[model samples]
Target: MKIAVIDAQGAGLGQTIIKKIRKEIEKDIYIIALGTNTFATSNMVKAGANVGISGERAISSFCRTNKIDGIIGPIGVMCSGSINGEITPLISKSIFNMECTKYILPLQKHGIYIPGTRNLQIKDIIEEIVFDIKNNLVLIS
Candidate 1:
């Protein structure tokens, strides 16, 4: 499965998701780190993502062309409006609107415009995702 992780300015949340995924699932999964900026993407790559793309054009183009299985990031990942206009909405819209199953963290005030999927802690969300994947796989077999 190809899981695209979007990070704006390397809040370090994206890396946490990748680490949990690797520990929980045995299947081969590809992580495509899409950073709203260079810093975000670089951190994700160091955290074990196979590929990393930074900048607006690359991020937009990749999301438009590819079909990612899932996406994990803060809700601000959708709007792109940051504190000082660092991460713009264009980058966020590209990934959020793309055809991918989304598991977004609630980070609205922190520059993520997350409307739904709120009030949940990061650890709880990650646990849910890992449990769901494992349960589904077991049922299938």
Candidate 2:
């Protein structure tokens, strides 16, 4: 299975998500780290992402052309000017257009809060993302 972990800023969340996927999933999954900046991409690459792409054009281009099974990232990924203005309109549009399931982390900083997700730790959220991916694989297979 192929999946994308999108992030911006320092990409700490992306790195964490990638690491969990590597640990929790035994399948030979291909991970793509889609970051809004070089630093963010590099961090996820160091965390074992199979491939890393940085910058808005590269991210949007990959998203438009690739066929991914799933995408995990902050809720801001689907919003323009999100991630402290790092998320571009094209990126948001591309993510929205992709034919895949999206696993959004409802981080309060994004300002589009989801009720009942509050008080959950980042580690827990990452686990949920991995669990969902595993469940999805069973359904698809």
Best by lDDT: 2
Q: Report the error of model 1 at residue 140, Å.
A: 8.9
lDDT of 1 by residue, 1-141 (tens): 678887776548888877787788747677888887788888888888889998889988998999877777766666556534655777777876888678766654763444555676788888887676566556646
lDDT of each: 0.75, 0.91
Candidate 2 Cα lDDT to native: 0.91
Model 1 vs. true fold: TM: 0.81
lDDT of 2 by residue, 1-141 (tens): 899999999999998888889888857689999999999999999998999999999998998898999999998998999889999999999999999999988888765778898899888988888988998878777
What local lDDT score does residue 7 receive in model 1, on the 0 to 100 scale? Answer: 76
